[model samples]
Target: MTIKHKITLYSSLFFSGFYALIALFIVMSFASFRAEEFKERLNEKALTTIRLLLDVKELDNDLLKIIDQNSIHQLYDEKTLIFDENFNLIYSSLDDTKIHWTTGDLEILKTEGAYFKSEGENEIYGIKHLNNGKQFYAIVSANDNYGKSKLRYLTTIVIITFLVFLLATWLFTFTLIKKQLKPLDEFHENISQINDLHIERQLATKENSKNEIDLLSIEFNQMMSRITEVYNLQKDFTAHVSHELRTPLLKLSAQVENQLLQQKGENDLFLKSMMQDIAQLNELINSLLLLTKNNQTNPREYESIRIDEVLYAAFEKISHDFKDISIDFSIAESVAETPEILEVKASPNLLEIAFSNLIKNAYLYSDNKKVQVKIYKDNHKLKLSIINAGSKIADKAEDILFKPFKRGENTADSKGLGIGLTIVKRILTNFDFSIEYTFGSYTHQFLIIF
Candidate 1:
């Protein structure tokens, strides 16, 4: 799970457990208080019964029973049994319902002076009475309906309150966590868009807030500032070096051409080879310059251009250099019917360079010095494929085919630098395009998806 979800879940669980414990404590404490209070009420009832029966001159058992039956203060299901010193029943509040008691119980009540206990849902209280120098035992039992009802009501309230608070806690935590982490989500999205072409871009930060997230943004901006500085310096160095070397290379090429015109036989052949070497060196320098120039290409310069036009341009350039090489180019019926299907949004110059490199590679490595180019639509996206019948590249070599200065095992006799595919990959990636190399049915294929 994400950090936001984990934090919210754990926090809500913690608060829920804490609240449940507090609710349990409240119910237990209130129940304890109610039990003690009811016990005291029962004790008071027993003492008053004993005093009224023995101490009052005018009140008799029958009159006292009538008073108890009509008393407003009488508890629910109240029953009382009075025993003399000899353990004989003398008084009972309820005539129909008998109070369960034994001789041993009366003796224990006499010795202890007072007792309180619970019998099922009823509370039992016993007391020893002393009047006119005579001992009497009294036992009473009753159910505290009012107190039990209050407890039940309180328990229900606590449960309902706990449920409501738990729901509130989960919702509040989810919303709060999502709100707090919104900045981080934006940071991830913005950072993912940063590339070597856009190295100068930086994350925005709040000026007044020093919270952890804001601090992270500030630090990220500072780091990007330093990286952009270093990147610019490196780019400047490469451009300057390439520019400075071009002048000497041009001079050397002019000298070689002049010598080739004046030489004869063996001397002419040697000068011709030297001229080829000079041309190769000049091509390398131009490639380096072009690579640097592509990095500095402005996104505003990109526009919708016909892919076939770029392909034809690249083919003409390659055909001029390799007169004997032939290429078979075709467009799918569906794509040919809709000219716009072959159009893509990119820098025209960069696309030509990428296409030229792939076409040249296909021509150079083909067994018959022939290349086949096809354009079609796949899954609603435009795709171009350059196929050649050549020695298949190993799986291990395919992985590094687009890495700088890396060549395939099949390119041992090829007369070109290894950065062509690398340059193509960089240009396509800048335009959010992709390329893949695959070999099947004795043919090598380079597929570009736009």
Candidate 2:
């Protein structure tokens, strides 16, 4: 994943974990609050019933009748017992469900004083002392029906509350985090506006945030500025160095040719060879420098360049000096479907130089005056290839073909510098294009992918 995706994913996960923690705290707080409320209700209801029973008289008769009365008695669902001074049961309203503890065991409440209490078998009892050592107790036993319903209700409330908390917390956290990071988004947009041509843009300085973010922006802008300086220096050096070498090379070539013309046939052969070598040397240096200029070039003017025009023009230019060689050009109508199809946005001069160098390389390789240049395209990219008749470059020479000063094993008294291919490589590379050379028994091919 990209950096932006990773940042968003991690930010969301972090907030999820944070929201989970917050939800846990909220759930716990609500549970504690609810449990305390349940306990408080139990205590208040128990005390009020106990006070009402104290006034009843006729011990057994009134107590039995009062235990079943509509108001206070119906509050109980299971066994209920009342006690007189003798500890005999004054009123017994026992259901079919067995109560684990009766009024006898509930005597523990007398010592502990009036309070709401629980009995086994899901029963709750309230006990209170009457005047003269008499006591009254109420019981409510829990059946499966009430227990299941109450449990279901409580569970539903908890789950609903938990879900709501998760949703609400996530939404709220997302909003807050988005707001906090809004400046980062703005900074990224500002940076994009500063193109490769000018990458010196910096984030707006905020007095409140003199932190790591500010440090990052400061460092990033500095790095881009430094990179730009180095790149410009390399380009300028290439152009200047090429121009400087041209003058001395022309002088040397002129002197060598003059000497070759004056010398005798036997001596002049050696001088002529030297003259040819000088000429090739000049061409190589010129090509290498031109390649550098093409690669580093960012000319202001560019338009729809027809592939056919550039290919034919380059072939004719290189063919002018070499009268002994023959080059055949072929362009399929399939490739010429559109005018702009061959039209790449580039400096015409640089493109022409690159094309010329490639064609010249093909001609130099072909000892027999036979070569072919083909122009074509695959989808969005353009491809140009030059094939020449020559001995295949050995495997060793193939590896170092694009590097400066590297000569092939078969380079006998070949009249050229080794930087021709290097220049082509550099030129193609600058425009995000690729070049590949394949050599076979009598054919050498240079492939250009644009």
Candidate 3:
């Protein structure tokens, strides 16, 4: 997962656990308060029942039951019992529900002077009452239905509120984290676009912002500045060396050619071989010069050049070099009628160099000195494939096919430096194109997707 998502998830979980504890505390505290409050109400009922039975001369158990049955403040399933000093039953409430009590319970109530407890779903409150020198025990039992209903309602509200707040916390955390990391996202996008050709480019930074991401951008810019300076120095050195050697090499080649024309002996063959060696050395210098020039060239200077014309130009040059080589070129029928379909925006010279290298490599390595070049539309994009029948490349050699100074295992007999595919790949990649190699049926294929 991305940093944004992970931060949001962890933050939300922490807040959820914290809020859940708070909700539990609130519900439990309220429940405890309700239980104590209901017990007080039961105790008040028991004392009032004992007072009416003892102090009022006209009051009787039968009349008190009528009063309790009609009282507006009556509790649900309320029951009351009274006992004389001798532990004889004196009064009972109208309800048939029995208030279970053992002698030990009554004795404890007498000793303590008052008591409160729970019997199943009912609360029981007891008190020792003394009136006119006579002692009496009063007990009351009832279910606090109203208080319990209030507790259930409060519990439901707490649960609902907890859920709503949890959702809000998650959403707020997600938004805040995404907003805080926006600069990092932009940094990744900008850094991905930097390459050796654009090594001087620097990431943009916000003024007066001192966050870690902004600090990273500043450090990266400083690092790239040092790298660009070193890269430019090296590039200038290589170009200067290559340029200084070219004049002497050209003059030596001219001298050798003149000598070969005049001499007619075994020395002529040796001089001719020397000329060939000079030519190969010249080609290597030229390839290096091309690479340096490509890096220096601005991409904006490229123009719309026809792809077919570039191929034909490259083919003409390859055929002159390899007298026995031939190429079969074809365009798919879907785009053959439209000449504009073959046009691409690129540097004509650089693209020609890339295609020429590929075509030359194809002809040089083919068994029959023949290559097939085809152009077609794939997924609405232009694609070109150059195929040659030859020994298949080994699996281990496939990965290094486009690396400089690297060649396939089957290319030991080929007469060229190993930097051709590397140059081709660099040029194509600069133009936002891609190339891949595939082998099947003893044919080596290089596919270029534009």
Candidate 4:
């Protein structure tokens, strides 16, 4: 799951538990208050009935009933009864019957003076009363319908309010967490896009807040500064060293060639050998310089050129170098409706160098000096292949083919600097092109897709 979903889920659970606890507390408190209030009102009714009866000596049972129905606060199923010491009913506010009171109940009330009890939805109480040497007992029973209705309404309101609170809390928590972590997301995007070419770019930071993300940005910028410094120093060292060595090598090559032409003794043979060695060194230096230059060149400097023209030019140069090689070159169009111009965006010089390297390798390694170069259009792409009849390359050769100074196992007898494919790979990668190799039983082909 994403961080946003995880945060929302965890926070919603927490708020649900917290709100449930609050709802439980509120319901319990309200229920307790309602029960106590109702019980107190019942006690008040019993006391008031006793006071009215004692204040008026000549009050009849019918008169007392009339007073209670009119003056007393009426509850749902309210009942009041007064009994003599002998347990005979003396007065009852109810219509027909007295409250069923056992002797055990009366004895308990006599000793305790008063008792209160609740049964399901109703409350009952009994009290012993004594005045002017006469004793009596009062019992009251009632159901608090108003209290029950208020509690039912209260329960409904609490449930609804609690649900709304949970929903609001969930939304508020998710939004708040997402907003706070947006800076981290931006930091990740910026880091993901960083590469060797974009080493100078820095991650974004907030000016108003110096939170964790801001600190991270500041540290990243510092690290990039150090990396760029070290990289520039290394590149400058390579370029300068190559230039410094190339001048002396060129001078040495010229001196040796001049000496070979002037001398006619046995030492002339030695001078010729020296000249060849010097030429090879000069070529090595040139390759190094070219690789460095390709690395530094900007992609925007490329121009459009006909790919077929570039290929033919490279093949012509290679033919002159290896005249004995039998070369076959062809271009076939898969679809007649395709345009004649096989153009692509690239540096012509880099294209010629890369193609020349492939063509030279094909000629040098083929058993019978037989090489085939094919160019065709397929699926809206230009496909070029350099196929040569040769021994199969090693299975693992493809892994290191494009690495600098890496030679295949089949190159034991061939003369090479091994930077040819390296240069080609760098050039093609910079231009968003692709190259692949195919090794067969009697033919090896290098394919370029543009």
TM-score for each candidate, following the candidate numbering: 0.68, 0.58, 0.78, 0.56
Which residue runs of candidate 2 sit more than 4 Å off their true CA positions?
1-19, 40-139, 143-241, 264-273, 291-300, 315-335, 356-450
- lDDT top scorer: 3
- What tens digits encode model 1's per-residue C-alpha lDDT throughout 347-371? 8888999999999888888999999
Worst 10 residues of 1 by lDDT: 291-300
**Model 1 misplaced regions, further than 4 Å:** 1-22, 52-70, 77-142, 170-188, 205-222, 246-287, 294-301, 307-342, 355-403, 406-421, 434-450
Superposed on all Cα atoms, the candidates' RMSDs to the truth, in angstroms, are: 5.8, 7.5, 4.3, 8.9
Writing each residue's lDDT as its tens digit, candidate 3 over 349-449 gives 88999999999888888999899999999898999999999987788789898888888777777667888998898898788889999999999999999
Candidate lDDT scores, in order, read: 0.87, 0.64, 0.89, 0.81
Question: Which structure is stronger by lDDT: 2 or 4?
Answer: 4
TM-score of 3: 0.78
Predicted candidate 2 versus true structure: per-residue lDDT over 72-159, tens digit per residue? 5243344445555455655545345565655555576666654444554344544555565555544333323344455557667767
Candidates sorted by TM-score, best first: 3, 1, 2, 4
Full-model lDDT, candidate 2: 0.64
